[model samples]
Target: MTETHAWKAEDFAQVNAPHVKTALTALQLTGDALEQGGAFAEIGCGTGEVARFVAERGFEVWASDASQSMVEATGKLCDGLPVTAEVCPAEQLEFPEGRFGVIHSSWVLHWVTEIDEPLRRMARGLRPGGYIVLQWTGAHPRSEGPGMFGILRDIAGSPKWKDLLAEAQPGSYEYPAEEVAKVLEEAGLELVHYEPDLPHPFSAKKTMADLPEMRERYKLAGFATQAAALGDRGDEFVDEVLTAMIRAGKTDPHHARIVARRPAA
Candidate 1:
């Protein structure tokens, strides 16, 4: 249920390119997945930056997004690369069984209601011994504790965020490591790696690095319909939260990241 609002390629490219690169570097994929060479799929291929990155390293890439504009933009970005782009939900992917050597999704899984079905699909889509890598924002990803949300709530007051906090309730997505291992096992994926890492810090003043940006991303992600329903007031709430976050960053930085992998064999 990711939001869609005529997103342009530039918007995503601007917001994620740096962060994605940082995440990718931290993952240290080492081009092993790319070397497998059957098909590599990236779920939530916003602007196709990560897809293109892997494509350049030699994987024949297949990428999809729920957003039509994002799909179109991703296609344009992968215009000449060895990548194919589609607009579809993870649950509806139409590739033949065992078609991919690698599957990837970056910063998008938090929007999912439950990852079991999609992970099942991904496991089914992989060739024997294929790899799956996912990088996403967790409760603490990109922020310290309650991270940016704490700042936003402080400035905007409790009323504005009460609804969002409820919607963003913990464990709605991104299971704890043990739970993730269980989900993968249930989905027929062998857990090869599961690690949590702190993400690079963001500056509200320098990069609009605050809760409003975070909320807008979630709104576009379509998972925050309840929060979006709050409308302009929701936006104002974000601003207030950002203001508070900026003040806090002046005192301490926030960090957030969740990285994991499954190898199908």
Candidate 2:
């Protein structure tokens, strides 16, 4: 879980335009619950694409991200739209009583260490009868290969570069289904809708919205150390990685999506 993401305001919007579809799906699932759901708060707003969409639909939106750059980018993108962007961590953000009706955190929780607490906090923050939609991705099975990390792991473990990448795990994280359910139950949230293991393939061809920007992504994707270790061959290493990704059309990513509501007290 090292620094694996490098996002700029200009590039993030385009590179992540694909995420807007998932954002729409979340909103579509929320439906009328959003009307009664009070203020809409989005954690991990990224470049605020989702926040902007939610605001365009007329809900008051407050967006937060761990990166100040991201918060600023969100603030800028969502400007003139009923949105407030801030810098905060999901676990640390206060979900005061009766404040938010729709609490949404998209594609963000897996980056966190303790997935349970954030769910608890989002649940606790919700108004009674308010709905919470939490979508966390990344449960990459180590066995699954040519998956993004698998390719990187193989390259790092290859005889040529093993020493430089002894401890490299580009994108290694797991979010088990049972743990997610336990957190929901613990928080007293009523089960509304749950979709698990939606595969998000990492096809370099499709994912690379801007080839030039994405070329820098290996660094952003937590290959900074290895890239640096490659020294004079760093550019060559980037080419090699990109070639591998292109050859492996799909990274076979696993995602967990959930929509639940706090029972009216």
Candidate 3:
């Protein structure tokens, strides 16, 4: 499960506003399963921006995330709004069967390791005609290997941080559209839309040009081991990783998107 304490809610909200906005736009194109008396649900709701936005659309929204800080932030963002925020991991989500019209997750899916269980759970939560819109990618949507996590690991294994981050297991996994489709199929969700390397708003990916800021992001994004081990020193290590990413042009990553639905029958 993605660690919660390492996340900075405000920081995440600032960097990922575009992603939530894009997800909201995709949800707008989805079918009207909510008309069947099902509410809208968002998995991995970082700061609850999507929940707030959707609630404003006049739908009761249920949102969850593994991070308690994130969940709390969601509550703050959607205060007095028709939204319910909870602290739950995607894999352990226990929504009532057929309770949601749309189950959405944006930049959150890539961090998940137990992919099948989460997909299965989300599928179970969907109403018969309900849909799920997912956005994810591999490393940089354009690159073949070694994303931010790999860079962090490489820096951790270097001479300077090798001993300091010895127990650091920092890694982020983003999957491709085809891979996501296969998982959705395995979970019994019929594919509706597939956009590979979706470039539109996804181009809003955080660039690697700002080394210090990027390092701050890297450390705060579930790098508990490194943070606990080196404390303030982790910043230097993250800077080196960011420098390497800049050198390799791993600046603008995109995400592949897929929209799928449960069978109406």
Please write out the lDDT profile of model 2 over residues 66-138, one tens digit for every residue. 6677888888888898898987766678877767879888777766756677777787888887888877665
Clashing pairs in 1: 1-222, 2-221, 2-222, 3-220, 3-221, 3-222, 141-256, 141-257, 142-256, 152-241
What TM-score does candidate 1 reach?
0.67
Count clashes in each candidate, considering only residues at least 3 apart in sequence or on different chains. Answer: 10, 3, 0
- Cα deviation at 76, candidate 3, in Å, is 1.9
> If the candidates were sorted by their lDDT against the true structure, best first, what order would they fall in?
3, 2, 1
Model 3's TM-score against the true structure: 0.82
Candidate 3 lDDT score at position 173: 65
Clashing residue pairs found in predicted model 3 = none
Q: How well is each residue in 1-265 modelled by candidate 1, as lDDT tens digits?
A: 5533334555556566566776576446524655555677888888777777778877788888867778888788778899888777665666567787777776666556676777677767777777667665543332334554444334434664665555443222333344545666776666565555444544223335445556565444322433444556656654554455555553132223333344433
| Full-model lDDT for every candidate | 0.58, 0.68, 0.72
- Candidate 2 at residue 234, lDDT? 66
Q: How does residue 12 of candidate 2 score in lDDT?
A: 53
Candidate 3 lDDT, tens digit per residue, 102-155?
888877776677676778778888888889888764524334776655665677
Q: Positional deviation of 263 in candidate 1, in angstroms? A: 6.0
The CA root-mean-square deviation of candidate 2, after full C-alpha superposition on the true structure, stands at: 4.9
Models 1 onward score TM values of 0.67, 0.74, 0.82
The deviation in Å at residue 246 for candidate 2 is 9.4
